[model samples]
Target: MKLYDHSVTVSSKRLNLFLKEIGVTDIERVEVNVREGGNLAQSYQDKSVNGKVPLLELDDGTYLSETVAISRYFDEITPNDLNLFGASTLERAKVEMWNRIVEIDGIQNAFQAFRNLSGIYADRENCVEAWGEEAKHRVELFLPKLDKQLGQSKYVATDNYTIADISAYIFVFVAVNALKVDVFETSQNIKRWFDDVSSRPALQN
Candidate 1:
């Protein structure tokens, strides 16, 4: 398998982190420099219709896009390996639920704010300052909710680590590292959770 990736973007980071956490290290990586318009090229667009990074190409010539789908595909192909999705039916539902919340309410808002405010994306798309401000505010609102969830559980979906935790961790990492927001400082529970997740050996890779 070949993973067409860009190291800097949030979605690419999430997929890379997921792969590491699941102990899948054999896949080859093809770097796509999105900032340089590598993803916008005809060659890349042919493989990924949406012109996005973190696309997974199977050995059988099947291409997969979308971070969530690629992560799930890894889980599906390696069912007997580490289970990042869930171990039980109910657990899978919970993981999916929390993953959706983190993606929609947390990561999406953060991305919107970054895309609109960052000069790096100025030529990539139309950015509205008002929309960026609104999106930043929404991210602030979502942090408290995530903190509350973390206070009740060690992990996002359950006691065990799952894809939901990976999703949330990447969002927080992007908020702090990319957006320059001190998200872990917003809540003690989140800070603790972040520290715990960060200590995982998989992330060191």
Candidate 2:
């Protein structure tokens, strides 16, 4: 299997973290800088149609896009029933639920904040500068909700480190590190949970 990704992009971190979790030693990676326009780097330029990073290429040439999809694929690649995904249907559903919340509430807000404020992708599709302010508001709005959720749980779903944790943590980690959200100040439990996840050996790789 081969993974096509950007070296520094946050999305790539998700795939890399999962690969580390599963101890996938046989996979090869092609890291590149996909340009904003048509000028894409050599590694994924040919395979990428949307010009996105973290594209996974199966041995048969099937291309997989989206960070969450790719991370889940890698997490479940092994045949063992014991994995980050829940062991039962209800457990899996809960993980999925938290994953959805994280995607919408955490990741979306952070991306909106960056795209609107930093003007990073302003040259691309919708580039309204006003969205940045809205994104900041969205993120701030979700902090208290996150505090509520963390008030009763250590991990996001299944009461353990499941895909939900990975889904949420990857985005929140990026926000704290890149966006400087000061998550520690907003919620102490969130800070503690994040620190625990950050200390995992899979992330260090």
Candidate 3:
């Protein structure tokens, strides 16, 4: 399997974390930098084209896009019984719920914040200051929710860990690193939980 990715991107983090968690090691990693104008990078986004980083090209010539889809594909390839998704139906639903929230509140919010605030995508056509400001406001709103949740539980959803943690973890990293969010001040419990998860061998690398 060949995994296409780029450094510091949330999609890249998702693929890498899932691959490491699943013990997938036979991967041929390909890096694509879509920072500005990379042909192969644009191809991946336009599915009809041959480009997209974080795309998984299977040995059978199948091209897989989307980070979560790619991660679930890997899990199905290895073992359908893994607990990363969930052990029970209810647990799975809860995991999915948190995953959705993380994708929306964390990933979406962080992306807007980074692109607008960091000048990373400042020169892009659709980039606007208003969207970035709104995103940062939303990010501030999300921290309290996470802090409250973490204050009550060890993990995001159920009693055990799941892909919810993985999704939320990577996005939080982006929020702190790229968006310059001061994670510790706004949410101590969330900060503690993030610190614990960030130290995991799979993430620290």
lDDT of 2: 0.74
- What lDDT tens digits, residue by residue, belong to model 2 across residues 97-166? 8888888988888877777777766556576677877876777777777767777888877567876777
- List clashing residue pairs in candidate 1: none
The residue ranges of model 2 lying beyond 4 angstroms of the native Cα positions read 35-46, 80-82
Model 1, position 45, has a per-residue lDDT of 92
lDDT of 1 by residue, 1-205 (tens): 8999988777888888888877787888999999888888888899996788889898999999999999998877764555688888998899999999999999999889888877566767889988988988898889999999999999988888988998999888878877787786778898999999999987885
* lDDT of candidate model 3 versus the reference: 0.78
After TM-score superposition, the amount by which residue 202's alpha carbon in candidate 1 deviates from its true location, in angstroms, is: 1.0
Per-model TM against the reference? 0.94, 0.87, 0.89
Candidate 3 at residue 202, lDDT?
79
lDDT of 2 at 92: 84
Best by TM-score: 1
Instruction: List, in order, the clash count of every candidate structure.
Output: 0, 0, 4
Sequence-dependent TM-score of model 3: 0.89
